[model samples]
Target: MEQKIEKLSTVKIQKSPDVYKVVDALNRTLKEDDLMFGLALDEDKEKMVFTIYRT
Candidate 1:
């Protein structure tokens, strides 16, 4: 179960309540493709940072 995750791209998005849902869905749907999604909060600007990774 050793995997190397590499950051592909990242973008700042407007905060959304369903962000977690989106990330979960992506992880489930794309796991077979070696793709992972992550979400981070930028509290200072009240924004969501979405990052894509390849394993």
Candidate 2:
């Protein structure tokens, strides 16, 4: 069976951003392997869904 992942929180950031900076910030705020995260962006042809996954 698949396990259910609980959402601790939801946050919004700028689309098509420098992901390294975001990860660095998250790493500082959250402990290693203690959280799950995702990013959202516009799905238009000229836009990109630049996301960085962490846990």
Measured by lDDT, the strongest candidate is 1
Q: TM-score of each candidate?
A: 0.87, 0.40
Worst 10 residues of 1 by lDDT: 40-49
Instruction: Give the count of colliding residue pairs in each prediction.
Output: 0, 1
Model 1 residue 25 lDDT score: 98
* Position 5, candidate 1: lDDT: 86
lDDT of 2 by residue, 1-55 (tens): 8755566665444554576477667756764666544555555534434344444
lDDT tens per residue, model 1, 6-41: 999999999999989989999999999999999999
- What C-alpha lDDT do the candidate models reach, one value each? 0.94, 0.54
For each candidate, C-alpha RMSD in Å?
1.6, 4.9
The Cα RMSD of model 1 versus the native structure comes to 1.6
